[model samples]
Target chain A: MDPANRPLSPHLQIYRPQITSVLSIVHRISGAGLGLGSLVLAYWLISVAAGPEPFDFAQHLVGSPGGILLLIGWTFGLLFHFCNGIRHLFWDAGYGYELSTTYVSGWVVIVVSVALTVGIWLSVLIAKGTP
Target chain B: MSGRTSLRRVRDLGTARDGVHHWWVQRLTAVALVPLSIWFVTSIILLAGSDHARVTAWISNPIVAVFLMLTLIAMFYHLKLGLQVVIEDYIHAKPTKVACLLLNNFGNTVLALSCIFSVLKVAV
Candidate 1:
């Protein structure tokens, strides 16, 4: 096959953005983010098992400003991936394939993810008596 | 005559026929993760600010320990599958893609094993 004669598909630069496409991309990104974030989870569990000294150190690190930011990002990542994964499951089940329904579900995933994340953090704050 | 080339016929019979298996397993793991993740997040939130002994005591519960193990396995397996797809899509180089895929598998296994081990240590 001649290189010059090879067929090329439309690239991202030339493709129009749509909600479904954007959500699909974000789902992949958030999945990757959560994969890395699992390390933090592992660290917390391991530290706890090690002893109180390490557990307190881990807690302090997690409660620090930088750690808080990382946790926030991970929280959103987890929630977004979870919501979108459910949407994908619906698609797999042969539902929500219509263009309108796809768009609606995409928005629903975004809204639900944000609401859940905020709700979780709000409860945490209330429980801590810091709100 | 069939409207197919000889090369196409042979190519269709190639060895890498496991795509469906991967897809199915990924979906299965994703479904398993739904409840496990909810359980995990809620447990963490409820345990927040609790002392080490308290947290360990929670983990020591057989029910909690079992769920924790399930979560670790399902989460990492799903994660590996997701990252495998990402790597396969973006990494065009053959050697690099294969290397990344291997690393993803091994790395996730190590991470999951260490997590499950910790949980068991605390629980047991």
Candidate 2:
């Protein structure tokens, strides 16, 4: 088979940026991010089950500055993955077929994820009475 | 009048029927994940300050135990399907795709088994 002779779909590079495009890329990126993030969760579990010393060490790690950064990244990763998963679900259900609806949903995922992350942080602060 | 021959105009099967099956399963798994994942996340946060006994007891409860098992199965099952799609799209070679797909299942299964064991150990 002559591969060079095969017809090709229009290249994505030529298309102008669009919300759908961002959403499409982010969906995959966040999925990969969250996949890696699962390891942190597993580590946490092992620590918890191992006993006091391990648990305390795990806590300190999670509580340390570097750990906080990872936590923040993981939180956003989870939120982004969840939001995009919902968006994909909508598409699966046959909603958001129109370009406008697609864009709207894309923006909604972004906004909702931010709101959720903020809401979680707010709840944490309220619990600690720190913010 | 004799019936005329039915001429069915054939258009290209856009996106193919297999896609619908794939899309449907992905959505089904996604929907299944909603409540389970909420419980999973909230449980983790709640367990944040919980001691070993507290965590173990919570996990040991029959309802949580069963759902935790289901959660493991559903999560890895869902992950397998999602990763398979990525492999199919990005990796062109038939052998490579098959290898990746098989490796994905193997890795996910192993991961899921370990997590499930952890949960069961806590419960027991």
Task: List each model's interface RMSD.
Answer: 0.8, 2.2
Residue-level lDDT of model 1, residues A3-119, one tens digit each, is 999989998889899888899899998999888899989999899889999999999888777887788788889999999999999999899899988899999999999999899
Clashing pairs in 2: none
lDDT per residue as tens, model 1, B15-64: 44556567888999999999999989888888877888899899999999
DockQ of each: 0.73, 0.31
Per-residue accuracy of model 2 over B1-124 as CA lDDT, tens digit each: 2112233114424444356566666677788888898888777656654556676678779899889888778777777777888888899999988999889888887777777777777777
Give TM-scores for every candidate, taking all chains together and pairing residue i with residue i: 0.91, 0.80
Off by over 4 Å in 1: A1-7, A129-131, B1-15
Off-target runs (Cα >4 Å) in candidate 2 are A1-8, A125-131, B1-22, B93-96
How many steric overlaps are in each model, in order? 0, 0
